[model samples]
Target chain A: MTTAIGQYQYDQVDRDFLAARIEEFSEQVARRLDGALTEDEFKPLRLMNGLYLQLHAYMLRVAVPYGTLNAAQVRAFADVARRYDRGYGHFTTRQNIQFNWIRLEDTPDILRLLADVDMHALQTSGNCIRNVTSDEFAGAAADELVDPRVHAEILRQWSTLHPEFTFLPRKFKIAISGSPNDRVAARFHDIGVIARPGDDGRVVFQIFVGGGLGRTPIVGQELYDSVPEERLLATLEAIIRVYNAHGRRDNIYKARIKILVQALGVAAYRNEVEAELAQMDIARYRLSPEMVASIEARFAAPDLQAPEGAAAVLAEQRAQNMVFDRWVRSNTHAHRSEGHIIAVVSLKPPGEIPGDVTADQLDRLAGLSERFAYGELRTTHLQNVVFGHVRQDQLYDLWRGLVDVGLGAPNVGLIGDIVACPGLDYCALANARSIPIAQKLGARFADMTLQEQIGALQINISGCINACGHHHAGHIGLLGVDKRGEEFFQMTLGGRADDQATVGKILGPALPEDDTVDAIARIVDRYLQERSGQESFLETLKRVGEAPFKEAAYDTV
Target chain B: MKRAVRVGAGEGLVITANRLLDGAIVWLSADHTWQTAIQRAEVLVSDAVSERLEGVQSRAQADGVVGIYEIAVRPEVGGPVPLTMRERIRAFGPTVHPQFAYEQQEGAGA
Candidate 1:
């Protein structure tokens, strides 16, 4: 018999807890079923897991699918606020949003409302499936072998309350990545899928299951061979079903699929998955060609005419304006089209918390999207906003407008583009304040001249290993740890954000809060001093290794 | 410093469960005062004074001086009334615990 993907499954005792919760919710629902409990009485239950209702009393839990939202999605969120909520929605660090002012009596009506717009809170708070997340740059980046979004979306549809998979022991989280360069923090997810091309020209996924970073941090085990595209959804269903049957249920923490994967050796897990796939009625649940076609059609890039003389225009801008040229080089990337460029709005400003877009800024971005870019937005896992289609001709205008709003910092891929979460200030789970640490580091690297010299570097910070800020994927990752009730910061070097993704190694002991920024500066200065010309930060780190930087970062301190 | 008070649009009303303790709907008035809008089916005085409301207790604690309550309010009838709060702290929105009132009590000690 094949073992489960993760060794831990809910036992009979765990089922008792799940049943108790269901009963509790059922009682609460019954009390308000016929409008008995007023709005005030029903709010606490919703807020516990970041859920809210919108206009017409429809419930909407902002999916924090890893705290990455694009300018368009951010704007669309504001639109959702205006249209559905009362022009205001609360942001949660789980990378989700919630509108608290909803009518509980109209929950089903709201679910229907979301379904009308191809959106639903389907397993948002339930024990069933949840939103499948991937690196926001899945398709657009120059380094990816294949877009992981197609796979993520495919999995998303398949797992939306699949009858057999819904009543699992506990919540499950899945993250996918094509960027081996480390865009998505794959190591800390229940099931982390990394897309790689095999020697046979087939797209293979290196499956890491049962890895998570909460109270217990463990790296996932690989449990699959090159799972082909056609069999991806079916394979995932089998894995979930296996976990549903075998995952631990006694303790909530142990119920995660990660524990199950850990308990079962990778070989055993793989064997189980293979056996389960073999026994399944694949045709019944397999994504049909027509369904795939319809979904792909919706995600298809919008048609646009290529602006003639785009190259010459960029060349002229570069020759005359160094600032504009630097921005274009760092912040803009070549689109599949001849004249269009995808622009990333780096949320990392020196001393600014990543992924926070103020209400006013949200409005301005909405206006900009309608004007320059086709009203499409994408949020990157690196905690930045992206405009998918921007014409080269409109680049200067967009940049100038963005500069007016204090968003035209050309540090998109540079050292200054830090990803940080709202730590102790807002998060009930955080042990230390992450925003201040990120702010301090951002201030240290605020100089545009210094940033240009360092080139593209991602510095991610997490208040805790829930990894909300994606600290595991950064080229230079900083994690906030609590020591004897005191806040301390740890630094990791050589992490990357591209297709050949590798988690950074820890550089000796953790630093005190006071010396954290300077320690980072020392590391950067060391790279500047020792690196050969044209060598990026990751390349320099790999070539010279973390020894030199570690010596510089800690020895003097 | 003068705090700015504006009539922002009435976002949806948030009704929580605690206000329904003993099956009564509790609410605060616009003037930062505790008052019962409804109690036990019958209209006990067409307009009851804020003081006569049931379970409206005030105290000076280590945190600050504030009122703790389990009062009820209904719109026109003795049912769940969705009253919109403006510039009122304690009754700003529907919350999980009616006990957790939003008061400027933090600055009261200061």
Candidate 2:
């Protein structure tokens, strides 16, 4: 192997394997294009790298877990945009980027380029393993028990082209949440891992399995109360092996782990995972302490010296700039450090499509990450960017920079803090456009005072029920449906975004386009009028039930 | 008069498919006059572009100013379709979802 950059580094064996795979695929594509290879022969090769041709031409989706990227990695994406794609990329609600147009010939080069930056399209698509996702605020969130990224990365390394598990019956998705606030939609993934402090004061994961949305949406079952940190990877391997051996391969839709879990029940599935775990050769497959240490060392945060006069600087900014202060209050979360705060950049502006960042905006965010946030950039599942370690002193400067770019809205946890997917407009799967509805809702609640009065509400919009926007997790969820070539929306209320999360209950009949925003306004207005001064939206909705909200939402002219 | 327009991102070109048709893909050129490569082409192909332009075209005729044919025009799928402001808005979906309750059910069924 080539000299290791560090322990647990990307060795020559890995690089050579990937390179050979790319060349083999390239040759396969060449043969197909030249009429030497049949579609059957080429299918497996394309499936290996997460490339797929749907009803339209080929679409290549690259998974970015919980939307975390360093400056260098962002630049690499920019390279992919400039080189392989048509100078732009579409970011999906799953924290992935889809390049809709791609020639089969150039895919190998794209893979090679991605390999250079320690990324690949491996298992991003197809009917086998998919990329693992975690909370975007994992390592940096003050409220997190531990960084879920470590576990996600570990899973990613283990699952990448594992011979035994590459050909599962259907696609599998795993999401982990480090934050107590369920930001990663853990309950909706095939496997959900939530990090928590165990009895021994060590961080362990509570594992859930089988939750998914498609033709049938079912909440996942809790498989483990707490799995020891050391045994996490082995336990995951066991789960996969069990699913691979028994999951239905006859009907493609019934092949997902969700069906397996449903068929076996949670108790049986747990028993199976345990049985498989007991049979595994732990000595051969387990991650050694040294390997774990090496990976952890690579992710160590830079030493940040506290800025002088940070509090006074923030105080002055807050006093002089109402907009900046509102942004800081709504969009910025407190950091563990005395002077640093995590500033979120909301992409959900009124009337704008969700997760639609322009190339110029991406470049600017990358530059800002380098300048004011110690070069760390994170994309939240709520469709926003987090400058993980921004100093309080730089708040005004950062706000000014964001304001110039039309991103300085302070509606983070308020009703305006909306999470939406690109609906019918861009997605072949969507029934309606979710962005415009989200935008209108955001603009309606644009007043900072009103937003603060509403307080800590999540409004999630999904074009369809695939729940890409995690509508189920929102306190107020909006789902789009198409009626006779016309768009309609359904409202669900009383959902939670925390540990005791529940899917929102649907209100009444769908409202008209012009009336929907006002309908939401009426709901919020009723909450404001009826709620006790300190009660949040979810709490108020729970106490009053759906009757009041339903009445308010539909009573509008 | 008939014209073709390159809509969305990629290689699939949309043709008027016949003379005197107006679809969202049709537009004025840089010179402030109607022009379309797809409408002007002698042949059209069944490809990604054709699939995208399927319903947005006029009926094909034996002899018309614009003709729609399906052929494999190009092998490579280009990037996102560069949409006009109007197209971008349409691409986003309806302004509200509740307005079309029946359509929502159909979408879910699909």
Q: What lDDT tens digits, residue by residue, belong to model 2 across residues B1-110?
A: 32444333333432322122111122222232223322222223334444534433332221211223232222223312223322323322233433322121111100
lDDT of 1 by residue, A184-284 (tens): 65666677888877787656788778766555556676677577655777888888888998888888878888777778877788888878989999886
Residue A130 C-alpha lDDT in model 1: 66
What is the TM-score of chain A, computed separately for every candidate? 0.79, 0.89
lDDT computed for candidate 2: 0.67
Those runs of model 2 whose alpha carbons end farther than 4 Å from true positions after fitting are A1-18, A37-47, A52-58, A82-88, A100-109, A197-202, A511-515, B1-110
Q: What C-alpha lDDT values do all the predictions have? A: 0.61, 0.67
Candidate 1, residue A498: CA error in Å? 4.5
Q: How many backbone clashes does candidate 2 have?
A: 26
CA-based DockQ, model 2 = 0.08
Q: List each candidate's DockQ score.
A: 0.03, 0.08
Residue-wise lDDT of candidate 2 within A345-424, one digit each (tens)?
A: 88766655556665666677777877887776777667677887888898788888887777776777778778887665
**Model 1, stretches more than 4 Å misplaced?**
A1-49, A52-61, A64-76, A79-128, A138-151, A177-182, A185-188, A194-208, A211-222, A298-300, A497-499, A543-545, A555-557, B1-110
